[model samples]
Target: MTVVGIGYVGLSAALLLSQYNKVYALDISPEKIYKLNKKISPLKDT
Candidate 1:
């Protein structure tokens, strides 16, 4: 499944859905994508 945008809500949904299904999170930020690819949290929602 493809989830567009890796924001707080989007990322949360992707992570939750990924447990049972394949999820590809999409975002407009290259830095964010790079961090996510490296298993790092892209945004700190606090």
Candidate 2:
């Protein structure tokens, strides 16, 4: 599954869906993609 835009909603959906499926997250921001690839959260959260 390909999830475009890794915003709050998109990221959440991707994370949830990923548990049972192969998820590929897409974003226009290279930094965000890079962070995700490195196992880092792209967004700030508590």
Candidate 3:
């Protein structure tokens, strides 16, 4: 499945769907793209 955007909603959905299928996340933001590419969490951990 393909998911556009990497904000809260898009990222969450991608994570869920990625469990069962290959997920392609697309975002125009360089920062977001970079973070995902590096497997870094965009949000702060608890």
Best by TM-score: 2
Off by over 4 Å in 3: 44-46
Q: How far is 44's C-alpha from truth in model 1 (Å)?
A: 1.6
Minimum summed lDDT over a 10-residue window in model 3 is located at 37-46
How many residue pairs clash in each candidate at the backbone level? 0, 0, 0
How far residue 41's Cα lies from its native spot in candidate 3, in Å, is 1.4
Backbone clashes in model 3, listed as residue pairs = none
Ranking of candidates on TM-score, top first: 2, 1, 3
* Candidates' C-alpha lDDT: 0.92, 0.96, 0.90
Pick the winner on TM-score between candidates 1 and 3. 1
* Residue 40 lDDT in candidate 1: 94
Question: lDDT tens string, model 2, 1-46?
Answer: 9999999999999999999999999999999999999999999978
lDDT of 3 by residue, 1-46 (tens): 9999888899999999999999999998898889999999776657
User: By TM-score, how accurate is candidate 1?
Assistant: 0.90
